[model samples]
Target: MDAKQTNGGRRHFLKTGAAAGLALKVGVTAAEPRASTPALPMPEYEKLDALALASAIREGRLTALEALEAAIARAEARSQINAVALRHFDLARENAQRLSRMGRAERAAWAQTAPLAGVPFALKDLGVAMKGTVTTQGCAFFKDAVADHDSTLVQRYRAAGLNIFAKTTTPEFGQTATTESRLFGLTRNPWNLAYSAGGSSGGAAAAVAAGIVPAAHASDGGGSIRIPSSHCGLFGLKPSRGLVPMGPKMLEGWLGLSAQNVISRSVRDSALLLQLTQGPEAGSRTGPQPGALIDAITRPPRRLRIALMEQNPFGAPVHPECLDAVRAAARLCESLGHVVEMAAPKLAIGEMFGSMGIATAAGMLASVRMREKETGRTAREDEFEPLNWRSLQLARGYSAEQAFTARTVFDQAARTVDLFLGEYDLILSPVTAAPAPLLGAMSLDQPYESFVKVAMTASPFTAIFNMTGHPAMSVPLHWNGAGMPIGAQFAAPFGAEATLLALAAQLEQAAPWKDRRPVL
Candidate 1:
């Protein structure tokens, strides 16, 4: 687990509970390949990108049941990764039949509507809800919090005609970066079974990377989305604070510290999902930008100056290899015809993210307390990692004056990054300080400082955007020679999802990763 291992050897260091899950004795059964991927498809599911699945359905190349069957088979074959949280063969089959009953015009409308229709989408354990299924946020208190109504995101997905085939796992309260929870144990990386998938959206990254669904829903308050996406070699975006709505229940997530988005294998898929799920809910305060997402994907980004970041104020070391990855990405952008230059802005990392973390952890603690009151049970001290307790304490310390000062500081930071973006179309940086880590590399069971250092080191690149409310994305641009994937982040001005998306589309076209996969 040495960070200085130059040869890309074993680098395990996952959050608490993950190190133990890597060798759970759950052997993965390899499914027959789809005639392309280097990794054999697991028995339960064979993933198809959102766009590809729609095309296949439209062309009659495969029925929804056929696709679901392949996916199920692939899931079974790759059981070691432990991606699927709930089996929905019966439900998926039923929905596919219902789709078959649609009239031609209805079917056509469905096809052209949301970018992910007719595709199998896995819902991450948090935020989104599916009726009759448990929506535990990795807590034993509400272990039976079966969802009675669909979350806004889930409703929108259904409206777009996506089949809700399964649910993925998450760490309790999603406080920890690793995805291990007592309920589902641990979710391992698809590339190397001995490593972590990453969290709080770790399960989605693991499932998507394993070709479980091509992509799954992900969220980030403090690098939850980007860290896992970077670790698993997928596309991850944390949108402008208000771009997507969280309504009928919440106006802002983690006091505006988090946003929900998808982590996928393609830029187009992320683009389309952003289009569908972006914008405010009915009772939302603000609406999405006045433009179409499909149109954004087609718009070519103008070549422009770029600001590259490569330093941390927290005394955390950015591994030499990770720095190399960022430099390589800078050169790639130059090769692709953009003026790239190094520029790390002076930022207050620990103070800002610490505040944000407190707010987020407080949200979970509030939930825990509520459950304690309602269910006559509480989370024992031993049940949560030390950082979880610290987050609760930090959030409790938020006085009225402190809250006001925090908001003012965030607004100021937003302006700073906005001014920074005015000169450059994109900001290039490493998504994490290191590459993919081995299981238990990070620990929910460790001391608060130990877990914080590990989690922050791997995810120093993403939270700055949450405070600023900018649109940012993680593109899977690098693969360590030994087969682990690494991601580099690119961010744009506030409300500039279009620019970020178009730039990502250009990269996708130039270096397609559709058929590239792991050998199970």
Candidate 2:
């Protein structure tokens, strides 16, 4: 149908029946008051971060079921964004009801152990798995692929007392920068519905930005975590490779390039989540020990040298607003008593991306083949998106020698970044070369070449740190004349997540972003 006609229908659906059937199917009675008696208004609930919400629940001011219902109400209200891929609202309510059954003394004792107990959380629909849930990964071929077991990360999330209610949208296999796929349509930005919510964690960012939840599970293989955080005005941290578990199903993702974490509104939520979930599982390779991230967030980092890079390494033209955001962040750092200089590590940008592409293609092909074996059906080209089909073809063409060469390049780049960090404590740059693009600008249905061009131009900085295995983050510090959020990127040495979190907390204190919520 025509664009205007389609949007008009969407608006009508959202206004009338978008969430009606889903609420009934999930057995959600959002209008009914809970027994705990006084529930906070939606606005007040949205104002509290996950930590504060947990504190309130612990103190008996609110019940876990009440918080879950509030989140459900918001999610239903913001259904027009199409951010959610799968809803487990009934299961989440069961979990929350279990918590509500506890006595006040029992609840307080449990809260002391499970710091974020009673907070609602969503998982990105790509990497990682939750038992009995279908992790479609935004691919038609995997649309019915139900996970029989939870990934190690999901176990940790449950242990931390987070209520997993839904799965967020993602691009097909998370191959693109924006979250749009045939399986789940466009996940739009909460700030502006026409604009894109950056991906492959777009839905996670959208949920948080829309006030459905204060934080959600997100993974970064390329720029997935930080890109959406930038677009949606949230704080996202991609911990160093091997710090967070990615195992039991797959040992590492994209040859150690992907790290799982959360896209959160507050620094402490991200820090505490990291502290709770990080560490190697049995039989997994471990990276450098991440020091106490909670402690790091509480205390400001010592003033140190920070490198500010404005130019895109790939020679792409960065938007003026993005450049302005980075400059403003640099000035903010200086005001906070840290030294900021204009410098970037020298590296073969072309080779780095080339290696990443090879790894990405191979990973996609492997996943497809594995699924094909399990299902006893070969995947057809028609079943895949254009870019993903092209990726499988490229993966078939590459030789073993080429894959080895890509690994070598990854190693060399990691060494180069490690040495660069010896001279500077952090690298500050734009999370994306531009602010979030409008929807359809980076759709995977387009020609593979054109899609790659747009994706690279939009997110030129984040994948490099992913390749180098360094911890990086996107801090929402600036907004353009149009009021779109622009995030400043920060990268530290491998295993220095503590340092990154500390500085992020400092920035949060110096220029707070907690009060800025999208008017959904």
**Top of the candidates by lDDT:** 2
lDDT of 1: 0.72
User: Distance from true position, residue 144, model 1, in Å?
Assistant: 0.3
- The TM-score obtained by model 1 is 0.87
Best by TM-score: 2
**Residue 406 lDDT in model 1?**
71
How big is the positional error of residue 122 in model 1, measured in Å on the Cα after superposition?
Answer: 0.7
lDDT of 2 at 225: 96
Model 1 misplaced stretches (Cα beyond 4 Å): 1-47, 103-106, 112-115, 287-290, 373-379, 382-386
User: Mind giving the per-residue lDDT tens digits that candidate 2 earns over 1-520?
Assistant: 4546644653453334332222101121112122231332334566567887787667555678878988888788789998899999999999999998787789878877788889899999988789998998899999889899989999999998999999999999998889999878889998899999999999999999988898999999988999999999999999998999998888789888889999998898899999999998987866878578889987789997999888899887999999999999999999999999999999998998999999999999989988999899999988889889988998999989988898889889999999999999999999998789999989999986777778877668999998889999999989888878999999999999999999998888888787666765
- Candidates' C-alpha lDDT: 0.72, 0.86
**Per-model TM against the reference:** 0.87, 0.91
How many clashes show up in model 2? 0
